[model samples]
Target: MTASGRSAALYRTVWRWHFWAGLIVAPFLLVLATTGAIYLFNDELNDAVYPELRFVPPAARTVPVSRMIGAALTAHPGAVSRVDLPAAPDRPAVVFVAPAGGGEPLRVSVDPGSGRVLGSLVYARTLVAWAEELHGSLMIGTVGDRIVELAACWTLVLLVTGAILWCPRGRWRAAGVLWPRLTGTGRRFWRELHGPVGLWTGALIGFLILTGLPWAGVSGDLLQRGSAALGVGYPASFRTHAAPESLPMKTALGTAPWTLEAAPMPRSHAGHAGHEAPLPTDDAGAIAGVDRVTALLAAEGMTGGYRLFLPGDATGVYTAYTYPDRPEGQRTIYVDRYRFARIGPEVRFADYGWVGRATELGVQIHMGNYFGRANQLLMLVPCVGIWLLVVSGVAMWWKRRPRGRVGAPPPISGTRFAGLVAALAVAGAVLPLFGASLLVLGAADLLAGMWRGRVGDAAASGIG
Candidate 1:
């Protein structure tokens, strides 16, 4: 082929793959972008919407964490529990306790001053929880989760390929390409916004892909390894534990939503773990006297509302995570409940290894948590950009759809299908979602090829 022909062929191939990627994944992207935008400020929104449950009296003296836990336990008998301390001095300490009958998770909000139950709400809060459930799992368990993961992974590819296709052709200048002319018809208007907005938000979408892929099970592990190689480390404080079986009704309260139910505790062998002595029961009176940890926190400028969590198990330790805007500072720190000596701090931007820092920063940017309210507003740009991309992608696909009836063999070999297939395969192999999609596409292609071959044979036989 001539040079001109070769260039045309390359462009056609890129366009075909780009079109298919956008067509198949746009709805998924829409779901993700929209849901992610809502979730970006979930903490802020939750606080605003549920002020009564989230906030407490400014004049009240905060109660001990143990006392709050005790109160939560008293409310729900035989419930596995986990407590989330309020991030502010004037907010209620909320505990989620799981019930024995597999009922809805219980949320108990307690006033820190009087040790009195302030209010309780279920884990589900109507629309907010609905959005969360849809965003997190699509309410479809592992299958739905995997599907969303695949869509999220491939969205990066869509962004890249879309950007390439958006490159201006002929007389189209960079300015025209990057911004709408405002004088165009419906199609041109959509096209202009589609390209520039996508181009602008491409980085954020890519960041989302990187951060999101870490939840895709094996794929996530692989991504984590790659991140580690680049110097990223997992947050040490983000440890998972199996809940103890048959925990005391008191001990188990306030653990439900966080624990996923009571788990089988790891057994210690013979002399290593067997203790004839009874487990230390919660002495609320003794807990009240531990002034060292609270004083240290206060001295560190962490005055006011914070819960000092007491780990119920042998491996557990007391922990506290301060609110971002609060006086205690935005960092997460843990202290031993007994000794009150600081054990360690949870992962923060400063704590990241080189790659970990990049990852955290990227995620922070994506989540709108890095630069306060300004960052939150800045994120809206990309969220809207992604939504526009999805809309335009669907428009482009619809505009180019074949006019012929359904089930017709698609026109091929005109668009360098080989090159398109190769590019797609490369992307699919690296991205988990693309890989799964390729498998589905392969099955469809095989069936189509077989059907076409049979049709050709029948026509040839009739001619003979």
Candidate 2:
């Protein structure tokens, strides 16, 4: 093929891939962008929507943490599973309680000064929680999680193919290539809007996808297993020789740091045989444990709000977890219920390996926790831009599509086709879910082509 011919074939091949990937994942991308944009300001949004439950008047004097827990437990019928100390004097303390009879956990808000139960409700029913469920799992459990992961993987494909198609040919000018040509109409106008907007937002979109993948089902699992195999997983200091047969942090505690969710829970040696112990089994004992840990954390300069997950059983340990607005302030410490010694070394951001630290920082930025309001606004740009890109893409397709046909880019043939297929196969190997869906879609496309060819042949013979 001539140089021009090769260039044309490349563009056509890239366009075909971009078109199919976008068409498949556009709705999912829209849903993700919308939910993510809302979740960026989850705390602020929750405060606004439920001020009674989330805020309190600033006071010079505040009640003890034990009093807050006691008030919440008395008001709600459950064991106090975890308590979140307010970040500020003006914010209410939140206590999560699991019912003795078994049911959804309740989040109780308490006034800091008076130890009054401000309000209580099911945690899962909260707006922010609902949004998170939808974003992560579409509220449909594991199946939804897989679907979201697949969409995320294909989104990477879309970005790569889009970038290839966006490459400038001939003279790179400011008109249609650099900026949208607003003066044009119909397909021309939509094309200008789509290409330039995509070019501007593509890198940010790719970053978001890459960062978000650590939370995905398949990819996240792969990352964890891979990191563990390489011995760069959670810090070794976070683990102890004696592993407790306790629930995972996510199960025992309502929320935990992402890196430590799967890490084994350290056993409390307090009540174990031949162990020096003053195990706390009663409410008062639990309260004293909370007091001791709270003071210890404060003395150690662990500030900016922390959660204390109360020991559930005799073997259970008190877990103090705090993921502050700053990534560097992230801390997770487990204290033996009776003996009250640290379970393992205090797990902090500094303890993470380079890969773990990078993932944590990226997640912080992705979730708008790194720089607060400025970070939220900066992240919002790509989210809103993605919505616009989806709209412009659909509009362009609508304007240029034929009367009764799907307007996919023309298929390539011979070597170009084989190369594109191989590229997709490689992508699939890296992203299993995306690769699986790619195979299914490719099969469907092939079968559809065969069916159409048979129909055309039959019609031609009849005409003859």
Candidate 3:
């Protein structure tokens, strides 16, 4: 092959990689973008969908949280596990109840103003819950989680390769290259579809992938552990004066700080470990249960939507935490159940190590929750842009694809091809799964080439 042919060969090689990777990632991209966009409006959507359960009239003083929990327990058969406080007076407090029989937890929304049991739903069966599960694992558990992670890894690789192919070298066109041409047909139209959207929103899509990886299964674990090892993550030694409790906050609460998910929860000794004469309430507060904890949290500057997880046993502490849009308002607090005293120092956004703080902030931006509705709209650019990329990509493939074939780019063998494949090592090193797939693809390609050459040799022998 000549110089241009060699370049074409390299281009074809990358094009093949992009083409196959896009096909695999396209479906997942659609699912993620659609579900992610929906989740961005979780508060508004939930309020709209479940107005009776979620809303109440504003009052000068709403009923106590204790009364709200009481109402929830009266309407359901279970102990209160966690109570998600209302953001405003007009919204109800959602009390999560863990059934004595041991199944999915029940969530009861109670009006704080009137202390009325508005309604109940299974914890995992709510619309938001369903969407969350689908978003996390496609509702198929660990295998699905791995698939999603792999898809995410590949999506990043696709972004890199797509940028390479999209940028014109040795020649440039203002119309088809820089922006989509309004006047076009067939491949031109598809190029118009793929080119501009990919050009503009490509970086944002990459941002979404990186931000989301913290919640992924395999790669996420690698990142967390790696960060911890580097000493830039949440400090394992945060000057905890409390007991060395083994239960992590993530294991205890439904939502926790991204940094402290694996860190052990601060614990306090049981007040009623033995013969209990009903231990006297300490200086923390006169009240107990949800009311005391809520008061304590409110006093501690947790004025936003927060959850107060009730103690499960004698040793369990009440964990109050806020996972809001902006990281600056986020805090995780712990209170001893009986003594009502704080266990450890109040964990704020400032407490997070460098990596933790960055990750948390990125997570907020990724979800479009950092700046309210405007933030949501801004983050939505990539989500909608991905749809356009996928549609245009498929269209371009369909219009030009060879008849009765998958229509992958034709292969060429040369030093350039070898060098290009070698260069992918850097990418593979960064993304282990992507690197592994590349190796698998390379091996398969080698085998297929050998098989084709042998068949050709046999045909020549027969003709001679």
Candidate 4:
């Protein structure tokens, strides 16, 4: 085969994969991009949507954190999981309450200045919450998580193939390569539009995808374990203060720093190292006072919007962490519920090590939380660019596809099957979910091709 033949084969092979991968990834990417873009301003959006619950008048003297907790508990009797502190004078404090027995947590808004309960809403019921859930897992729990991960893994393949298909080939002409030409119509127009948008947005979108992978269920877990194996993953937070059977912090709190999610929940064990007493009962009144925890945190120079997770039972520790706009301010510290002693090593942004630190940095930037409004706007470019690619990709296929059949590009025989297999093999090895799906896709493609061949033979013989 000559150079033209190889080039044609490469184009045909990449185009086929680009088609399949896009089809698989398009819907998920749309949901991710839209929800993710909106969530970039989650704080702003929530405040705008529920000003009454989130806002309070500024006062010269404000009530204590304990008083705010007292107000929240008085309004709704339950165990306080955590409290979201006010970022500014006007923003109200939010106490998250897990109902008696077991249920979803409730967000009880309180005016810090007056120590009055403002309003209550289900934490899981808010708009941004729904958007977040859908973006993460399509609101269907574990199955949805797996699906989303699979979609994300395949998206990488889509990007790789798209890059090959859109790369500047032969002589670079500004008309279709550098920018879209407005003079074309139909498939020509879409082709011109798709290439330029993809070429410009590919790297950004790829960065987002790679960064966001750490949040995925399967790939994220592998990456976490891989990093740990390489001595760059696990951190000091993994050291348990007490029982090995104790719940993981992530399970107990529903969220933690990505690096510390699997760390054992710290307990307040008061003993001389060797001997430890039996765990105490779960009683709300028995735990340390919120004022003491708040005062201690203040003394430690914690001056931002921190989520103070109040202890539930005797063995529990008060977990305080800040969800700051930037990664540098990240901190997760625990205090003994009864003794009020600091428990375990405090996990900070610096303790994340190299890989963990890098992951967190990427995650912050991905969410547009690294640099405030400017970061949000910068991230929006890729989201808009993704939507543009989706539109142009579909348009291109629609204009050129045959009406009767699914318009997947035809396989070029005597061409690059080995190369295609090699690419898929490499992709699968890297992404387990994508690799598993590749087998299914290959089998399906084989069957479909055979079916098409039989139908063609039947037509040739004039047999239905």
Candidate 5:
């Protein structure tokens, strides 16, 4: 084939792969983008939704953490329960203690002043949970999760390839190529749908795709390697050898370089048989429950603002992660339900693994939480842009289908093929999902060429 012919063939090959991948994943991608957009304002939205549950103050002579625990156990006798402490200063202190074997946790909002159970409710209105499920896995569990991960990582290849196709080689109309000049209905509609939208939303969607892949189990390893290359220290060592006592929650909280921080309360992981007291074994009133924790925080004057995570299993410690400012500046503290003493090592945002830190910062950026509302509002432009890219991509594919009985053209020249191969290789190194996809694309292309070659041979034989 001639040089120009080869270039066009190469472009078609890439376009084919990009087209198929986008079509298969477009619906899921849209779901992810939409849910993600909603999640971006979770802080503001959640507050507005449940102001009553969140807006409690520290009253004088608040009940003790120990007393609160006793009260929760009394409320739900013979239940294996945990408590989630409110991290924010404005939010009320809630205890979540569920019964063993069945039923939901008893969620009670305590007055903290008299250990009075102010109101009881379930942990419902879980929009964030729903958003997370849709965004992460499309509500399809592991397989769905893997597909999303692969799609996000491969999207970079699609973006790069699409841009190449969009740039007309010699017949480049500057305005048409770069900016959409809406002269007629066709131009105006196409420009509105594709031209301007792609330009504006590219970076935002790119950020989302890049940051999101790391959370996928498939690309997690590649993300870590990339993070290490960027001079950020990803966690190289697991804390298996370190004793639970060695890592106190107070020490972790102190790592945050914040002005005001709370001290962790007395707490312990159940069945961790190492240092202190025997695990509490009373039928109804053995361990200090959630109410006691709220009161203790108030009594100790640790009430600038705080959050509490209820212990999950029998062995988990009730963790308290505190944030004074909305964006930066956070501290973490833990308390043992059984002992009512502090547990685990203290750590800060910066102290987390490199991937963890990046994910945190990325989340902050995604939410417009880092700077303020102004920054958040500015991000809406990019979000809309991303939606446009997905939509236009589908339209372009639909418009390009063959009219007659013509099959796909032959494979491109080796040189152009080599360029695509190289691109895929580099992308794979940064994200394993992309790396794996390159292999899949190559195999698919080779098979297609083989099938076409055989058809040509049969046709030639018939003519002879």
Candidate 6:
């Protein structure tokens, strides 16, 4: 084939891959975009919806954090699991309660001054929580999580193939390349819109996907394993001592810094390991430890809105966790319940290894925290753009596709097919779920081809 012919063939093959992948993953992408856009403004939305729970009048003197928790527990029927101190004096303190009878955790808000219970609601039923659930797992647990992860992986494939298809052949034009040609009609209009919009939003969408992969089931595990193997995942201090085998901070408490989610919890030693003498193991000592830790955190400038998860058991440590709007304020400090000594270096954004730091920055930006409201609005552009792309792509297909046909581009065979397979194999290796789906799809394709061949032979033989 001529060079031009080879280029054309390669373009067609990429277009075919893009078509199939988009057709399969567009609905899930739409869901992710919608939920993610909503989640971007989660705090604003929640505050708007429930002002009574989120806001409070500024007061000269506020009650103690312990008093707020006491009022919340007195008003709600559950054990206090965690408390979110208000970032500002005007905001109500939020207390997370785990129901003794087994149900979704409850979020109770308390007035800072009077220690009055403002209101309480089930955590899972909150609007922000629901949006989070839909975004992460589609409210279907592990199966939904896998499906979402697979869709995300395939979206990367879509972006890659779409970029290839969008490459300019000749001199670049303003219309259909940089901006959609508004003057066009029918499939022309949709094509113009889809291609340009995809180009504009592709980078942000890819960043979002890459950052979110750390939270996914299979991909997250792989990323963690890979990071550990490279010695850049958890903090170096995590391996310096024989820490107790405790649940992850996120698992034990409600929230933790992403980098320390898998870091082992350090145990409180009784005057051992070259540390100060441990405090008493009684209830009074626990209370004193809480006060001492809170004071230390305040002295260390652990800002408001940080959470202090009280030690749940004899060996449990007091975890002060916070992921503030500013990435630099992000900190996760674990203090021994007995000695009140920090378990590790106060883990902060600065303490993360290079890979971990990069991930943290990506996560902060992804969560719209890097630049506050501006960040949220900027990220929303890609979310809205992605939705537009999906809609326009579907409309274009509908206009051009023959009736009753799947509208897939012609399949490539020979060397082109081999190249496609090789590309998919590499993607699959990195994204295991995507790889599994590819194997399943390939098997189905092979079976369908055999079936069609059998039917054709049967018809010919009968005529013969």
Per-candidate Cα lDDT values, in order, are: 0.60, 0.80, 0.78, 0.79, 0.58, 0.80
lDDT tens per residue, model 5, 176-262? 557666564533455445755666567777887765665676675445445544545323222321534433333432222211111
User: Considering only N, C-alpha and C atoms within 3 Å, which residue pairs clash in candidate 2?
Assistant: none
Residue 64 local lDDT, model 2:
80
Candidate 4's TM-score: 0.90
For residues 36-78, what per-residue lDDT tens digits would candidate 6 score against the true structure? 9999999899889998888888988877777787777667655
Q: After superposition, how far is residue 448 of candidate 3 from its true place, in Å?
A: 2.5
Q: Candidate 4 regions off by >4 Å?
A: 99-104, 240-244, 270-282, 286-288, 417-420, 446-464
Q: Provide C-alpha RMSD values for all models, in order.
A: 6.3, 3.7, 4.4, 3.7, 6.2, 4.0
- Across 1-464, the per-residue lDDT of candidate 1 in tens digits comes to 78777776666756665676676677777777777788778877778877777777864467776667677768764343345656566777776666545667777888877788876777676456766667767878788788788777667667667777877667777754777555665666677667877777888777777766655654655666565445455443332222223232123323211111112222221123322222322444334433465676677665554544444444444445443432113354555555656654443445544555454455566667777888788877777887777787566555545676222224354344466677777877777566787798779977988888888999989953
In model 4, where is the ten-residue run with the lowest total lDDT? 273-282
TM-score of each: 0.75, 0.90, 0.90, 0.90, 0.74, 0.91
Candidate 5: C-alpha lDDT: 0.58
The alpha-carbon deviation from the true structure for residue 452 of candidate 2, after best TM-score superposition, in angstroms, is 5.4
Q: How close is candidate 3 to the true structure, as a TM-score?
A: 0.90
lDDT of 4 by residue, 1-464 (tens): 98888888888888887997787678888998898888888989988988889778986666887777768877887766677887688888887766665666678999888899999988588889998999899999989998988887877777888888887877878988878887998888989998998888888888888898898888888887787657576575565445366666676666787876656676667423322322222254533376778778888877548888765555666888887878788888788877776776677888776988899889999998898889889898899989989888888877788988779987886675676688779878888887888888779978998998899999999998
The lDDT, on a scale of 0 to 1, for candidate 4 is: 0.79
Alpha carbon lDDT at 7, candidate 5: 74
Candidate 3: misplaced stretches above 4 Å? 1-3, 100-103, 236-245, 271-288, 417-423
Best by TM-score, which number?
6
How many backbone clashes does every candidate have?
12, 0, 0, 0, 30, 0
Model 2 has a clash total of 0
Tell me how far the alpha carbon of residue 108 in candidate 3 is from the true structure, in angstroms, after superposition: 1.0
